[model samples]
Target chain A: MTTYYLEYLKLKKKLRSWLGPIIVFILIMVAYPLTVEFLEKDLEKGFYSLLWISILLSMMFSTEDIFLEDFNDGTLEQIIISSSSFPFMIAKKIFIYWIMIGLPISALSFLFSLGITKDLNLSLFVIFLAMISSYIFLNLFVFGSALSLNKGSVLGALITMPIALPVLIVLGKSIIALQFGINYLELLLLLLGCLSIIISTVPFIVSYVIKAHLE
Target chain B: MWGLFFTPEDFVQGNSYRIIYLHVPASFLSQSLYAAMAIASVIYLVWRVKLAAYLIISIAPIGAIVTFIALFSGSVWGIPTWGTWWQWDARITSTLILFIMYLGLISLHASFSNYEKADKLLSWLVIVGFVNIPIIKKSVDWWSTLHQSASITLTDKPSIDPSMLYPLIGSIIGFFGLIICLVILSSYVQILKRESTKSWLKDYV
Candidate 1:
């Protein structure tokens, strides 16, 4: 418990790490309408695609240095020496990131969806989808960040982005489901199922990856 | 060789259908090679088999080339059959994703100069990226894509005629044998390069 709090405070101090993604998300959402005409329908047409991609890009940006700071400072090495389970710390770190970064992006996605599509019900559903997907993306990108710990984040993004493509496909389908009022729950449940698997496995795998880096 | 002259041409696709002999084996081997790499990765990660690590990188380039062949031949086959080269169908798109993944694995390994660290990271990436395999396999069934579902299966009677099926089976076996030989050769190079410092390698070479 104290570890989670401490990690939370630690991340809270790194303002750029948490706040940058939200600002980027806002910039993307705000900038997108300019490229299209003044028509509301035209704006709605590209909104979800832009929304999901912005969320993906934002998550990737946010995790670019998830482990780098600690790694350079020998904090990770110390954590490994301590008796605490490394994977648990990783999961908690990701959870705090979700609270700090993902939750806000998801909420903003809801606001963006509501503003553009003018559909409150659909916007409400977008919130849930965004929240689940952002968490999933955060976990995957954190794994990427771990893989390319000393190397730049671009290599990490290159390798991890393909794995996330399927999730993007699912997110696109979920939006269609929302628009049509069919099987939306099933799709949401599918995302949840994926989140369950990823959330459980990534931290453990990342521990080994970080260990490889340390070695 | 027998698939070229012996098998009768399809009435629908005519001569263009002959490309199937090349396309099927390449596509089949592409996925199979990744599956093999994934298994090797598992072995390496779990048991720390140095040979398994060698096998993973050895198989990556061959897998990429084979995947590219599958995509190119599929495009050629599609032009005549579907009246277009690419349709972004599930199978084709997933296979393209597979090709990119092969490149990604190779690049990830190359980015790190340390071979051992590279091997460990590459293995984990291979294992994680294995999720795309089943998606490629079942894409036609999972979605109403332009690509057709499998005509051949172990569980059911083969939908293809005996004449075409036999030659295709022969060609797939021949192609797979050739790929295995290539993989063996590649592994030899990997072992030679990575193990140059070891005394046993000097004796073996």
Candidate 2:
């Protein structure tokens, strides 16, 4: 268990490599909102547009981290052979990822949401939804990157995007509902339920794929 | 087979509800075929059964085709009732999503070269994909605007009329029979492709 904590620290130390994808993705996040404004000519459109693009871009970037270093260096093989509980350990790594990558982006999205919705309550919901949505994307990315470890980012996007679309629609609908003062609890619960289901299952899938590829 | 020819027509829908004979069966197999793929995947992962892996490989394209059939029939049925070829309704959207996921599985399976590693990855894809079934099933009941509530469930008494219900039952059975035949044919060819040098193929090849 503590070993996973050490793995998390080593992963964070590798952030310098991610700087490129992060900067580029953040630029996209900021730029996409401008397009939304051009259509509606409304600044508030920035909030929802930012949240959606940011969550997706964050996912696209962070997923690159899932198997890159370990697989590239042959460390993943040794780790898999040593640990009987690879999936749980990987789950911990995902949690740490959510903390490092997902949390900051969620916070940024919340600030943007506040600018668009102009409602503190809805913005906060945006933050909460951002976090859970990121968690979903991260887990799905873990699955995608494991399969596409050598296949490149296009395959990763191809694999995860279709699976993530339904979840995205649910989250987007709830956010839009919140903006309109519609009751959102049902949608919120549904989103959370789907999140929990993804949480419990995806790690095991990733672990099996990782082990298989390592072998 | 008897029910297909014998069922009474819906008063409002006239003969168009007849599409349900094809639509409902395709939808049922589309969803169940996914479950079968997931189960085959689970069996392959746990046991490393080559046959189960073949099931996973063969099941995907079949699942995709059935998903397409369901969508096609639903859209055909939709044109008369909804006055549009496609509506962004919840049930309809989820089914489209389901079809795309099946396509993802096929693409992912095709991308890899190593049969052994591919089997594991394929199983992983199907098992992870099992999550979509419930979302698709409940989408209509959860949101009320478009697509009507499901008229039949395994446990609940079907809300459908008996005259109409019997044909649906026959169509579902017939569809399953057809799918089973197709699966057997595909799996046999796949095995031959993979095991062409084996002694078992001496008899057939």
Best by lDDT: 1
What TM-score does chain B alone reach in each candidate, compared with the true chain B? 0.98, 0.94
Single out the weakest 10-residue window by summed lDDT for candidate 1 chain B.
Answer: B4-13
Task: Report the TM-score measured on chain A for model 1.
Answer: 0.98
The TM-score between candidate 2 and the true structure equals 0.87
Candidate 2 interface RMS: 1.4
lDDT of 2 at A59: 76
lDDT over C-alpha atoms for residue A76 of model 1: 98
Off by over 4 Å in 2: A1-17, A20-29, A36-50, A83-85, A176-201, B1-8, B155-157
lDDT of 1 by residue, A19-138 (tens): 998999999999999888989989988889889999999999999889998999999999999999999999999999999999999889988898889899999999999999999999
- Candidate 2, residues A83-171, lDDT tens digits: the string is 45788878888887887778777887777666555679987888888888888888888888888788775676666776787777788
Error of 2 at A28 (Å): 4.6
TM-score to true structure, per model: 0.97, 0.87
User: Which residue runs does candidate 1 get wrong by more than 4 Å?
Assistant: none
Tell me the lDDT of model 1 at B165.
95
> Model 1, residue A70: what's the lDDT?
92
Error of 1 at B98 (Å): 0.7
